[model samples]
Target: MSKLEHAELVDGVREELITYLQNGTVNKQAVARTLDITELGIDEIDRLKRIHFCLSSDVVDFIETLQGRLRRIKTANQRDREITRGEVRGGIDWQATTRVRYTESAGDRTRFACKTPYTEYDIGENLVLKKLLWLVHSTVQEDISDINYDWRREAWPTERIAMFDRIYARNVHLNRIRDGEDIRVTRRMLNTARTARQSLYTDAYRLYDRYRRLLAGKYEDEDVSQLLSNTLVIPERLPRLFELFCIFQLLRCLSSRGLRLQPIESGAKQLAILESDQYTVDIYHDQNGGLSFHVPLSELEGIEADYIDRYQNVQRRHGELVDAFLGNDTQPSLFSGRPDLVLEVYESRAREVLTAVVLGEIKYSDNQQTFTRGLEELLKYIEFAQYEEYLSDLDIDIQGLIISDGVETNRDSPLDGEVTHISASDLISVGYPESWIPTQIR
Candidate 1:
C-alpha cells in the first residue's frame, strides 16, 4: 500500500478503537469483531490487540478507583447515621463510675450520685462497625458483578482467575455476615475484611502489571515507553479522563472557597451547585459548554450592555464552531475547531447578563507533532475568540489554556493577551484559578 493508503488504514482503525472505547455499551469483543484481523499483517494485529488490552486495563483501573472512592463516601455516611441512631437508642450508663455526694437531700442528709458515666459497650461504635462490615460486603458484591459480566468472557490467564476466585470467596463470607445469616462482627472478622481488601488490591495490581509486560514485549517497533507512561493507558480515553481530572480539581478548588459542587444524581451530564436548584454546570467532551455556569440575567448599565452584547456574539460564534466541529460539513482546519474543555462563567442577577469563557485544550501525548498541533489548535481558538468589537466593548474575557503532558514550545504565545500554556501536572496540582473564577455569580 502507498503512504496515503497506510495512513488512511491507521486513521480508520484508530477512529473505530476510539468509538469502541467511548461507548458505554460496547465491549472489547465488539471492537475485535469489527476489525478485519485477516486483512492486517501480524505486526498490525499485535499492535491493535495491545492497544485494546491497554485500553480495557486502564478503564478497569479507572472504575476501580471510582468504586473505592464511592464506597468510602457511602461507608462514612452510613456509619455516621448508624452511630447517631445507636447513641440515641442506647443512653449513657453509670456502671463504671465513682459515687459523689450531693448536699441537702429532702429526707436524707445527702444523696449519692455517680461522678462519671459511661456505657458498658459503646453502642455507637458497635453500630458503626456493623455498618462497615455491610459496606465491605456490598462493595465486594459489586466487584463480583463487574467481574462476572465484564471480565469473565475475556481470555485472562488461570492465575488471574484464581485470584478473582479467592477475592470472591472472601467477599462471600463477609456478605453472609451482612445478611445476618452468620451474625458476627468480631475483631477477627474485621481483620479478615481488611486482609481481603488488601489481597484484592494486590491482585488488581498484578493484572495491570501483566498487561504492561505483554505490551512491552510484543510492540518492539513502537515506542512502548510512551504507551506505558500514559496515565489512562489508552490514548482515546485520555481526553475524557483529562476532563474528569480537571473537573475533580475544579471541585476541590471550589470546596475551599465554601462552594460545594456535587455530581447530579440523575445521571445528567452536569454538577449541581449545592443549596441552589437554579444553578448548575454541565459537562461535555471536546466541545464548548463543557463546564457551563447557568445563571439568571441581571440588569445592567450602558457599559455592561455592550459587554453582554459582545459576549452573546461570542457565544453565537462558538455555537457555530461546535456544530462544524461535530459535523462533516467542513473539513478539519485551523479555523474550524473546538476546545477539549470549555468553562463558561455566567452572571445573572437582574436582566443584562455578562459572561466569561475559558477554553482549554488537553494533549495527553508527549509526541512532538501532537504537542505542536495542540498549540496550534489553542492559538486558533484564541484567535477566533478575539473579536475587535468584543475586545473593546466587552467586559468578558476569553482565555485560552493549552494543557499538555509535554509541550515543545517555551515562548509565550499571546492572542489579545489571553492565551496561556501550562503543563498538565501543573494545572492539576494548582487547580482552578481563584483569580479567574468569580467569587459571586452576580
Candidate 2:
C-alpha cells in the first residue's frame, strides 16, 4: 500500500480505540489488547485505569443501595394485588403521614406524605400511583437499564461518576427481584429503576450505536476494509462513503421506521426532510417558474474566496477541457445549448474531492480524506437507480464526476463505470487552464 493508504488505516484504528477506551466503558488494558498496541502508549492510561478500579470496587455497594429502594416497592406490590371481593384494585397508598418531615428545615410544620401502593383508596391519584408502581416494577424486570438515578446528584466534575453509581444501585435492586427475595422490595426497586432507566435513555446515550452499526457495514468491502485497517483514515477526503450511508440510513429510518418526516397527502412531490452530517441539499421551485436546487455549504471550511481560488480556477478549466473532448470525439446533443457540464473543478485537490455543481451536491474540505461507508451507500443508490441508463434513455448524456482533494488514483472500482473520479490535484496539474485532460489522468 502507498504511504497515504497506510496513514489512513492507522488513524481510523486510533480514533475507534480512543472512543471505546475513553468513554468510561472499557479499560485501557482491554483497548490495548483489542488493538494489539502497547498499553503504555495510551496518554490517559492512569486516569482510565483508576476509573476502572473504582467501578469494580464500588459496583456491589452501589447495587445494595438500589436494592433497598426496590424492596419497599416489592412489599407494596403483594399488598396491592390482593383481590378484593369483586374489584381488581391496583394503586398507591399513603402508608404513613407525619405532621413534620424535618425539624431543622424551613416550614418544618408542613405535613409529610409517605406514599406507596394504595390498599384502600380508589381515588384517581391513588389508582394512578398504584399502576405506575406496577409499571415500574415490570420495567425493572424487563430492563434494569431503565432505573432512575435522578434522586441522586453531584457537582459537575463528578456528575457522570455519580450517575454510574446510581445505575449500579439499580442493578442491585434488579438482582433481588431476579433472585425472587422480598417481593415488595423488588417491586419498589424496579419502580425506581424504571424511572432511572427512562431518564438515562432520554438524557444520555443518544444511540450512537446505530450510526456505528450502519457505518460498519459500509467498510465491509475488501478494499475499504484493507485500506482502513492499515492506513490512517481521514473521513473528509472520501466523504462519499459516509455521506451515502447517512442518507440511506436517514431515509430508511424516516420513511420505513415511521419517523416524523413524511410526505404530504396531496399529489405534491415532497418525499421527506433529510438531515446531513456535513451538508444538506434542498430542492424547490425557483422564482422564474423553473426547478431550483439548494445545496448549502455551511460548516464547510475553505469557503473564503482566496483559499478556494485555485480550486475554482481548476474546475472551470476542467470543464473547458471536458467540453473540448466531447466536442472533438462525442457528438453534441441536438436539444440543449452546451450539454450540461457534468463535472467542474472548484478548489483543492490534495486530500479530498472538491467540486461545484449547478444542480447537485458540492462538498468542500481541506486535504484528501478517505472514503467512508456513507459515500458507498450514496453511490449504490445512484448505481441501482441506473442513473446513467436513465439519462441515456432521456437522451441526456449527463456526466457524473467526483473531484477529490487528493491525487487522482487509478484504484479499481466495481461502481465507477461512466462516473469519473478525479483528484483536485489531477484536475489542476493537467486540466486547469487547458481545454484537455492529461492522458495519464484519464
TM-score for each of the candidates:
0.35, 0.21
lDDT of each: 0.40, 0.30
Off by over 4 Å in 1: 1-236, 262-284, 290-335, 349-352, 383-394, 408-417, 431-442
lDDT by residue for model 2 (1-442), tens: 1222424434434444333323332233322222322222333333323222222212223333433343433323324223222232444222322223333234433334433264333322222223333332332333232223322121112444444445434554333332222222233433443444333221111211221222343344443333233321223223332222222222332233222232223232222222223222221111100121121223233667774565556555666788887763332221111111122222232313322221222232323343333234334323322222322234322333343345334551235343444433332133322112112122
Which tens-of-lDDT digit does each residue in 1-442 have in candidate 1? 1112223223323432333233321233323322423223222323554444433444345333433433322122211111121123223222211121122233332232322323232222222333433333343333222333233234233444344435434543223223432344454434434443444433333333444454444333233332433321222323444444444445445556554444334233322232223333333344344332222122222445677777656655766787878853322222345666565554432213435556667665556777678778776665555333332246766666665554545544544346666554554455323443433432
Instruction: In model 1, state the lDDT of residue 159.
Output: 48
Per-residue lDDT value at 257 in model 1: 57
Residue pairs of candidate 1 with colliding backbone atoms: 296-348, 298-350, 298-351, 298-352, 299-350, 299-351
